[model samples]
Target: MRRLTLLVLLATAAPAHALDLTATVLANKTAYIPPQCYTRTEDAQGAVHNPCQTCHTLPRSPNFVSDPDLQQDYAIPGPALENPWTNLFVDRRAAVAATDAEEIRDWVRADNYLGADGRPVLAARLDRLPPEWDANGDGAWAGYRPDASFAFDDAGFDHGPDGRMTGWRAFAYVPLPGTFWPTNGSADDVLIRLPEAYRQTSDGSENLAVYKANLAITEALINRADVVIEPMDEGRLGVDLDRDGSLGTATRVVFAFAPLEGVTMHWAGRAGTLGPKVAPLAAGLYPLGTEFLHSVRYLDPRPEGVTMAPRMKELRYMKKTSWQSYAELEEGALAEKKEDADFPDRPKQFFGSAEAGIPNGMGWRLQGFIEDAAGDLRPQSFEETVFCMGCHGSIGTTDDSTFAFPRKISGPGAFRDGWYHWTQKGLAGTPDLVRADGQGDYAHYLRTNHAGDEFRSNTEVISAWLAQGDLTPEKAVALQADIAPLITPSPERAIALDAAYRMIVREQSFVKGRDATIAPQDETVWRRVEQDAPTGIAEPADPWFYRLKR
Candidate 1:
């Protein structure tokens, strides 16, 4: 009965073009894999290969909540042994060479996400119960509706027409240094919605002040640093906020090793400002009902400059459906490792229907909608979603199987401690992120990775940052002040890359590969690899945060 329901849902929800593609993908699921799973093990020397450190690394400070054993060995499971990403092997230079750059530019610039009525196209479509997306045989969409208006209040909450909060709050953060950087391929944004309990005061009343305070506290706990917040009345809350033995005016949430010791306030706070009471807030984990909505889009390259586009390439959703205690998370990781050891070569299988989502072994379940051949959103096949689990499920770099939220820009310098959207303010004039040891983040990435992206194929970045075949100290200093020059692609390269990806979409060959490439990537990628083999590195590399510490 469950299988029949799923078949009905897929038949009703997926478009004809997507149905064919999904069928093809499902028929030979094991034959397909993402190119990123194949790490570059060998360097130019062909010796001292060190690819394991990219995803598998020693857990670092502020991220010690994950499995520490992941750094000790390679734990790749099934479907990762072969390289089915044929897109990487394709020579797309001809397609790029024949493209009308101007026409492609105009098409990209035209917004596909919004209608002439100035409302979201996906939102309107979902509201109408379109057969192509109405799952469960229900007349209404049961899944997440497009509620983020991109219009946020001062506290970063999105409000609907009834003037009630839509519950989706958009926040800005430093983009993770590699492919996630806009110059690589896509422009993206992430919005978070906490469970209703977190949005209320101690007495269960919906007060915006209490909500903002709760968010600030969560930010402080996640980042493990003092968070600056707008001034609020602490006396009325009846919480002895500063540990100063009295209810006082509080300007920040103090992250302290000993809260009773009365730690010093952040430098951004005014003289005599006190810390908020944080004894009640849990550390490192979001509530079980939390949801994150992320949208990946194309780059809007205009004659003047490049910015984020309104047309989305993909929409991803993650929800925490269950709560795994700290002991449970550790036990789960060890159990999975034992299973991998027993059958290292066997591909691990995930259990779930495509209409719902696949569980990531942790508490979260992920689902994604991507563009079809016609550039409209459709559900991603099971195999495509498996690619997401590899990173979110067991990567050592993640804190609680997540990124972005922990790396959110904070302190007084950031605009509202980075709780806004890209549309509110793009990534220009944003200073380089400084690590705990005060090293520049972007500069360190370029120095270590030697390229803007993981593939090291971004010629635009290589030419700019590695003009002399190396990133010199002088160039590194310049990047520390402003990162725009290091991360933004030239208008010509942006248009060409966009054109290259559209070719893959038209071909409906996402099962084979989905990377946007102007040419074949033979130099950096492998066709196949032996499972559980040594990655050829003597010592595991540190996590991205720890590497920047020096």
Candidate 2:
């Protein structure tokens, strides 16, 4: 009997199977390699090679490197004098002739041009290619080389049957600037938003590219996360859910880590920012160990009726499912006893989902983890292992129900006038927090911040196309005037307008032969094509802007 007791103690004393990792250590070892294309040349005649990393890198150049449509045909010179080459060779004078450059661009774009040794040249563009493509010449451009896999979802995600958000679609929820939780434990705390039961509007006005740019910029400012779940202090950071000038009874906030998606916008003609840029990893995306943390809060007994204030309406509480990478949970997790003394920090609870097979847990890596605001790893209860639905799974946010859209410009130094106008006057329990918009100079925030450059550039180019269906020097000037007043009073509103206008221009840019060489008679069509591409080649929407605001 004594011998049997000794064996039980030995088994119990042994630490949970191999999960003894600190938050920092775990973050360092499990580096996420973003998907990109690459080129490798062995011989003078070898074919150019492109893996995922290689494909995503070419577009990052200041000049156009590859065409999304794979257009190799030379473009006819027009009065505007656009570069017709599909490759990065933008200086037409360097080519033997314009047509020569165009032909070379085509060969490189198609990934079919043979080098001296006869290997395939790497394809340069991914935004234009479908999720899957045929690199092996099987006559099928199946979804991205192996399976149209996305960097976030390549590890396999689960959204359950009812939730269809995954793959590239799930990227819409990636966090934005100003939302990164600062570690100072001071006033720069990131706000926690509750999930709205019903959506109030259908205005899909948030420009995704602009949103993405802000996120990239913010990633440069603050990269660490305080992952601890803090109890919401009604007097400190709570919002009046019903705009009734009162805080909710209880609010629990959570912050977790995720991989940063594509950071900068890499359009053919757009200029990059003068501000600092995040260096790309070998995979051409954010490097491994680079982390993006998501913040969510839960409010009990959601309020009803919206009165210009954010509202949460529901009697019952809602929580998100767990998300996991393609990597499976470590063995022996399931059999581990939940009642074990150390169960809170156990790997099973950290990786398991409260709601099994739900969409939130699968693609977004919304697994439950225990950590403080400083990212100090801790143990969490199985009950607390719910996934985050406040942003990714919410039903009312403008950017596909994610806070990425609204917070795009809501971050520090974003608003010149401050956010006072958006809320009611003298809300009870509100603190005297200093913010960019506090001075009532929204324009101050709009003109000074780096995002202003992106917004103005998008507005100047996209607004012209929306107003005239084509771009002209005169049309461009006129549209800029119309958008100027709206920019300062409300930067977020202006950004939403910019997003909406760009959507229209993007729809018209993808018509067939939009990039092909053409005769003078086709000049109008070509000009339309040029104007059409106020954004990049990829259609953010299927029927361009359909259900955009929903």
Candidate 3:
């Protein structure tokens, strides 16, 4: 058939090459623009809208920027103005259409985390460091080891085969609204690990009860609200667990707006909690040394439904390597803006050692590992890691340069107060997050973006949520109760998307683009744009803070 010939031609269109595991980090020729921002739509009045303000706006707490005016523009460095993603231009419809859905489904469902011999596959790969990935020519990997066992205790702590805690704790939160949703080609999970001091009692003892209380306290501080916890002895903490003028048996960790007398928290001091100086520390500011491991995986679509594949497509790690005072954060942001104004065409340059990971300039160091041509995990090249710095380094939507943990579900309705993994409970009955304006989050996104994803390409979502090609009041109301129907793709779509991405993996063409598209995305993205120009919108959209405001 003609279809088979076209598929064969497309598959061989691009030549395959050996994996590039080099550990060289390269400077960006232009400031990067994420593909997500390309998802633009016109209002009913036919006015074009740019939603860049959603991720680029003034901070809510510790309003760090000295000049709010500078925050309005894209303000990328002059040198880094070129769009670096070349894969956007490549057409892949033939390859996607040619895929055998069932075959891709079976491949995705295959266990990738562990070998049939019962050992971690990624761990084994990492143990044998390839010469190409060793930037310094050292045979050892200097990065954090893949220690997550995927086996969790009741409290969500990852436990190894030796019955020892791996210090990684998995938590469930509503995925970020757009590209991060599972229907968009990947199923991912986030795990958090605090410093050893916070996981210890005032007496320096490793007591689980005290550790739980400390974690709850940190959570309360970040969220600025009372946090529920199982009953614990307050005497062991040696601080007023509940700020009611005295310490007693406590069931909740109460947050105090002001410092309380005789309630000095030694644990807070150890965790480097910088009590209100110029402004209150930004909401969701974690203590230094907190580490987060995130895994982006393939979607395993089945007769039943789609779930996360054990085989990871990408493993991302970030750590709060240093603490930035509120003043330091503001100064750095302002300086970047000034540079943008002075040199509108000069590309931004990043300076960091490749092996340690690139600094996001917000106290966090980010590193990542992605799949090779053979579908085995390999270290991302320097240019590959540079793709990550843009979002994490200076995004208005994030709290302390992070997204998921701050959005972790809370309140009595959440399972274990939102401390469990996705495997424990999928997003089946999770309700739509309510925005500050009291609008259902998903419904508002649909009404504004006019599509399920940023690309406006997900026809499946558009058809379901926007009956008659528009999101009516009835559809909005229906979404508030449960969002799984809107976010989860059909089994066929899932398999097709997975197969398309597998093609990119086989080609080792991540530098071009990483979007899992079944067709060429000419309409959704721009190859280049005018430097420092307005995004052709009348006004900026509201920031994520409005939705996160409790």
Output the better candidate (1/3) by lDDT: 3
What's the residue-level lDDT of 492 in candidate 2? 27
lDDT of each: 0.66, 0.22, 0.69
Candidate 1's C-alpha runs over 4 A off are: 1-34, 44-54, 60-79, 116-119, 127-140, 161-163, 202-204, 236-243, 256-281, 532-538, 547-550
Write down the worst ten-residue block by lDDT for model 3.
272-281
Per-prediction tally of clashes = 2, 51, 13
User: How many times do residue backbones clash in model 2?
Assistant: 51
> What range of 10 consecutive residues in model 1 has the weakest lDDT sum?
265-274
lDDT of 1: 0.66
Which rank order by lDDT, best down to worst? 3, 1, 2
For residues 192-254, write the lDDT of model 3, one tens digit per residue.
Answer: 987776666544556666557766776776666788777766666665677666657778778
| Model 2 C-alpha RMSD to native | 27.2
| Best lDDT among the predictions, by candidate number | 3
- What lDDT score goes with residue 440 in model 1? 78
lDDT of 2 at 399: 22
Specify the highest-TM-score model's number.
3
Candidate 2 residue lDDT tens string, 435-544 = 22232121222222212221122233224233443334443344322322222213222222222211212222111111111112221112222312222222211110
